[model samples]
Target chain A: MTRRRFCATLALCGLAPGAIATALASEGHELRLGLTPVFLDDQSIFLEAWRTYLTARLQRPVVFVQRGSYREIVDLLNQGQLDAAWLCGFPFVRHERRLRLLAVPLFQGRPLYRSYLIVPAGDTHTKSLLDLRGKVFAYSDPDSNSGFLYTQFALAKIRERSEVFFARTFYTWSHRKVVEAVAVELAQGGAVDGYVWETLQRSHPQLAARTRVVEQSPEFGFPPFVARSTLPAGDFKALQDVLVAMRNDREGKKLLGQLNLDGFTPGERKLYDGIASMAEKVANRP
Target chain B: MKHFMRDLSLRYKIPLRVLVLASITAILVTASILFRVYDETRNDLLRHAESMGRLLANTLVGPITHDDVWRAYEIINSPFQGGSLDQTQIAETILLLDTRGQVFVSTQPTQYPMLSEPGRLDPEYAAIVDLATDRNDVKPSVVDPSDSSRLFVTIPVISEGARLGTLVMSYPKSLFMPRFVDIAQRAALMTLLALAVLLPIAWYWGHRMAKPLVRLAGCMDQIGPSVPENLHCDLSESHDEIGRAGTAFKRMLKELKEKEQLEQEIMASERLAAVGRLSAGIAHEINNPLGGMLNAINTFKRHGPDDPRTLKTLALLERGLTQIKDTVAALLVETKVEIHPLSRRDIEDTRTLVTAEAAEKRLELIWENDITEDLPLPSTLVRQILLNLLLNAIRAADKRVECQVYRDSRSFTLVVKNDGTHIEDEDMAYLFEPFSRLSRNGHGLGLWVTYQMARQLNGGIVVESEPGETRFSVALPLQEEA
Candidate 1:
């Protein structure tokens, strides 16, 4: 028994301590925030600055859990591993029962953005989603409102299925990649977030110059910061307060500039009503 | 090659050799420098790619573990962004291979799809997978495949003693070509500049150095077994080796000239001695009989001739016999002679002796005497020399003869000139030798006798003949008898 206990203690010393520390960190002192590649450009620097800001204001260590697609972040947030996440409108409306809207990012002073239909700069005839029929298309993500749901909702209004409307389609999993696909002519057309395309035009003008915007969807609620429904009320309120008050702080405003955002607001649930209706329209299409 | 070089002229040989040696060294040095620069650039490019691979590998471990292809792509694509427009990206494509040897992510995702086998992507990557998947030691390796134009660097991504993935970065081999070409161009320009500066100096120095040697060689080529009297070497005055050699050659030439002069003098003396011996022998053999004949002629003139014809014949015999004795006496060169100072009258006497001969040809005779005092010379020898020259002049004259006598402090001089036809060049060589018949009148012994008389008096005679004038000049120096 003595030797067995010693071996068990050795095993605990070898491996269990790190696992225990990680578990305790997520539950007690650390806030694990999920980030999907939606409108984030220069991910590491922006994530680092946001983490520093949140850690200082909320008085807790902030850990940003970044993922390639919205599905991963949504899954983590629903599983309660992530306390909160910045997610697209479509995913938030679909998972509304498990997530709560913490704050809506203000882009150009409004908690609203639109989907942009883009084609190669030489494609002058493509002006609407109907004109992109039978062409290869790239979507930023399957669960994004601006990149996928809005285009599907528009197609559904004309009684069309996306798989049948476009000859081929693929997910680039990032809004910047959707713009890159259309810019390099890898895709004849693409659906991307309007904010990402506009930001890219400002930062990477040469890359954006190769692409042309054919259509802009009606304004929908911007992708918002949300918390898990199971998160502690104190932590949720603290995160929402920190995000909403970012415009009032100098360092927070600088970070918001880096993120190409005006500020954040505790927007109403009706702000995402347009995305909810689009998701419903796409899903209910026979 | 040695024989060929030996045959080349110094003018071309020196510069050619210097240019050849300099060109060879320049080519070798330039080639070596270019090679070194090429090697260094290639190594630097490869080292840069390797370090990039290592950094990407470290950064991609988290993204690869989480299956975040976007983050991995951004990490690999970072190097391609924000550089100058002219610069090409060093890493052409970067791939992240899972522990199962499948490409989990790639910078060129359309080309190398995710979850594809590494071998399916590229045959070279098949070998790279094995090197990268070495579990014991996951060291970074830079691979330059012989069959590809790309250089590959593989860094293994590890997390806590576990091999997470392999990061493979490929770089085009032509990335360093621009740098190498720049180095080569600079090296080539420097070599050409060096040659441009060095070649003309070599040519000018070669030309300057070879000039004197060429002159010396020309002087040497004119030499034979016998040296010439007026050989001149037009070499520059220098104290270098070739100049010293020229000096030695000139000294040798002088010695040879002196030796030749000595040899000619010895031969002339020997010939004179032989002639003296022969003349003495002839004089001994004929003087007694010639004396008896002359006595008989005188007796016939005084005692046997009473008829007019007989008297005329006796006078003719006496004159003929006296001429024979005089001719024999001329042949016998006298070694011992009574010395007497030459007076003005002796020279005047010579002019008088040649006046009748001059009249026979109807030649005008001009005589000018400038002597005021007696000259300390043998008067008989001086008078004989003067008379012989004047007679020869008269005989050769076409129109007139001129005799001039002068005395300076050191010597008494006589000049006789006549308007005459020029002597032939072939006849001039032996004009003073015995038995050289160069004229239509009188025995050729007259000038030979005059030459002998001048030598006996330690005087000299010269003859000049041209188209219109012929002159004979004699100079007799005063010497006190020992």
Candidate 2:
């Protein structure tokens, strides 16, 4: 519904886009995706819409299982319960070894977005993630990139220099929720991916009415669509080609627009390899 | 033991039943109030405690989430105290813990076991912990050791797959503590107020009741044959039992006083009547002898010149004659006197009349009845009544002068009083009866006839008597009716 939540939900799915390749290659295979947002029993019938879309393309039944957060997506992918997911850069970095990228989302013509630490328009204390120590910090999702992990990565950078981040951290669950948290003063400041924050400010003024961007992190790849690493190599390449050429076909372009992604690129694992390496470096350094 | 016996033996006293009822009622009412108040107060205390705990936990949530761990204690103190939390009056401990088992804050940290040490989780605590992890939706709840109905709430801080800490609070269930306690206190106070008001009313009523009995005793003390007048004691007009009894008792005494007065009046009238009848006849009878003595003395005086023997004989005769006259005079004085009756005259009135009452007692003659016939229309009843009294009187005259009867129109009045000391009021009432006498000289018949004749003629009588004189007057009704 909201860009921030869209990103979080993308991250909530416990698999990567490449997993579709494996499902396509294997006969009698069941296509599965782990969605991290909780599924209430009321959504059982409504989820059939997603099943229909996936089944028409794969010529098989596509199943969706809900998890509470992207951490669960990563856990599920590692456990092989998920074949693919639409995931944020943070958890992708953590479990990239177990996932494969199929597509990267594009906003304003680019696949890069920065994390912004936002404060209420009148707040005077915090200017950056590093300055948030002993002050309230709001994160959209613990597994979110711009909402949490990137800001956390900024903390990771400080920790590299032997410093701690904010004195306290709280979860807002989604990008929209994070901005809402700052607006409502539930937290002093919030961190969200830059594109999602701008998009939310334009769409939901009440959520952004009391907030302003105080700081932003270095740009990172936008949340990417990925499959689990266990998907077959040939099937992975076919899925990649199909996604990349999507903008050229009318139906494919509509699908790409529906998913809010620019045409897919001939993705090399190298772009995400560095994020994984950085996370490892941060985890190891601490 | 004395006090116990006093309380127990109160049964014999008039107010024992009232006392027992009052004591039992006071204790029963007070005890019931005390018990109810105690229970309600306890419950209210518990409810207050839980709310206080909630406020502290909610306020502290901000500081914990912000990681400003130290400010947590300040946050709690202000809210718990500022709000209506009275549970601080009781001993309690508040604790806050972080995910790493680090103690963040506590109100009375000293009361708790060392926070740094990992305390052994009882089965329940361990279960709650496990529940928080699997499902973040499960809120941390409260525990109450004093009452089973405790309440609590918990909030978990989760960020990026890491657990920050848990906010746990516990308090008792007090539904009616303060309100019910107030009620009990009020009941006790009300009972006391009722007693304060009621005791005086009861005493006043009791005093009213006792007053009549006390008056009865006082009146009894004044009693004698001629009792002094009784003092009036006021009592309630209420128809309550005591008032009714008092009214009735006063009425009885009044009746008795009237009866005594009536009896006295009747006896006095009878004695005066006796004296009346006696004088009229005695005055007439004594005149004859008195005339004879005068004639004989005159004759002797005329014939006396040179006869010595004759003179001597004459002197002897004169002396003898003078003695007889003195005897008659004395009889008249002694015969008539009025009577006075006392409240104690019951025994006196019963004694029969006798004669010569004054002479036997050595009394002097002070007055004599001088009337010969007291009625305009003379009756044999009056004549006989007179003779009976004179004969009786002659025997008792002793050294008194002779009596004479006198008469007049409009008043057939008669009186004969002896100078000899009159009989006491108690004895005079009996003097006119059949065999009664002031002394032992005669039987009682003389005054009985006088009494009967006076009454038959419908005459009224009156008596006046004291130490030196006794006088009686009988007024014959012969003063024709108009």
Candidate 3:
């Protein structure tokens, strides 16, 4: 029974989604989240919070990159342009061999979140991913775990290709853009980050109210803090320690609260194995 | 499952069918919308991509015509350096090809001049450039061949309609997905939202549409012969076909009940008419015996007081007269016939009618008649009754048939017993009913006719059967002369 429960927990977290390498090869001590505009609606506050916390803990100057698509951030990370980044689990798993696990955020005390498949608020026809075939769709990022990878995996499970299954698909590079596009009827449906969607519901009620979640995927490993494999061991440990202990410290906790998170937990390699298995399954599908 | 469904009442069947049909319709509509939008969105994406390529070609036209490779390089490289055409949003590669189909400049440094032979360059792009250079058409063109994964467009640098050089811009297949994914995601979301809102409304509407039918079914189930008149069905008030049907059904039930009652009344009147016929037959039989009895009484009155030898004659006469009197009393029919005093000769004549038949059947006729005076009842009915009973007994007896008649001032009783086969219990239920043939096969009317005549005379007939003896007895209330 315990083993079954363990397996169930593993399955719930999508430990096996997929893995790919980031593009940027130039490496440095700069840490930036390839945050599409949606992630840093006000970049100053977001960048300040991360820079102050990381600079104080790492004893190194930390610069945050606020502009760029998720793919750009991944490319920079791959080319060693950025030292570390807050990246979605999709890219993290994609570049599993090249990236090191730093830490994952704890939201509602779980290191997990979901992908929400959304449609226009007033639409009364679609019910599942299968129903959205040949319709215009929005994805948060090509490299995003919840935003794009899960949608691909879902299509693969049914032996369908996104190009044929959907009429047109495009990445917004930001979870917020996906929501806005769907809400404004620029797109008929979208795959969005659950956390971002929830945050938008609270932060921008009117925008969030324009669409409804049609599907909530099985819980998956949260997008986490990722660093290149070439990072110094001591520096990586310092970064992990700073995030994990964030809830325990006054300044850290205050910063986390603003982000609607408790703190961070130790990176669990096992947490993403389920996503890897999913990636394998998607690869194996006809 | 199919058999079970076949048995399902329409109340459930209708809702299930409606839900199934509606669900199928919803699915079909969603699928149609999804595929239709998908086609439209993809075409729109392709169009948009082509337009972007054309716009890029237009921007690079002047530099190529001026033979400014460095300036053309700056134009393509500007978009990569935070310019309007962001690197992620547009062309992956841009090149300026000279009139000789030699690459003069490109965004990538390694490919500054032609790296590969002209044949190595994209064949479709080379072909378009060759066409523009040869024809001097110098038109911007978007060329997307189905076999290739990359999108390429060619724009010839025109100086006074003279082709100077060509600008080639290329985007990989991945460039199309971002916009397409965004649009498709929104379409899917909208479809789901539409289903969520419409399905429930469909169910409610189906229920409302089937409501009258369900109610009508309930009414049909409750209807019975004994259902009360006041059990109201107000569904008839509605101005619909079902309401009209309810009204028709209510009328049908009322008419059926009335017809059933009328049938029962007609049957009773038929039985009464049958009884009247039986009584008339009995009265006719008694008339002959009554005339003879009056003559015998007149003879006795003329001679009984004069002769010495008349005493012996009187004893024989009294015995014979007593036999006649008992027979008439025993054969008295029901009360619907007017009472006429019984003559002593009626029993004697009825016994005489059966005596030969009993003798022919080798059965002894034991006639024990006790009646000796006149009684109030017509002798004709009595005669018919006695004759029918005696004939039934003679036919049934193996050796003997006994007819016993007795009368008091208040009542007359007659019993006919035969030593013969016993009547079966199953057959006894309908023994006195009309057209009942219980073994003897005597037109199946003998006992029923006798019973009806007896009923008319205010008397009843009963039969008791044992192993070797069966007896039919009838009793009538005696009436005095009016």
Candidate with more favorable, higher TM-score: 1 or 3: 1
| Order of models, best DockQ first | 1, 2, 3
Tell me, by lDDT, which candidate is best: 1
Q: Which ranking of candidates, highest lDDT first? A: 1, 3, 2
Please compute DockQ, using alpha carbons, for every candidate against the native two-chain complex.
0.06, 0.02, 0.01
| Per-model i-RMS | 5.2, 12.1, 17.9
Tens-place lDDT digits, model 1, residues B395-416 = 7788988988887767778898
Stretches > 4 Å off in candidate 3: A1-42, B1-482
Residues A1-286 of candidate 1 have per-residue lDDT tens digits of 1133235334432432364457555767678887776675345545566776787798766766666679988999988899999899889999999999999999999999989999989888887878988877888888998898888888889999898998667777888888887775657788999999999998899989899998999999999999999998999999999999999999999998988999999999999998897787788888
Error of 3 at A198 (Å): 0.6
By TM-score: ranked, best first: 1, 2, 3
Chain B TM-score against the true chain B, each candidate? 0.59, 0.38, 0.45
How close to the true structure is residue B196 of candidate 2, measured as C-alpha lDDT?
69
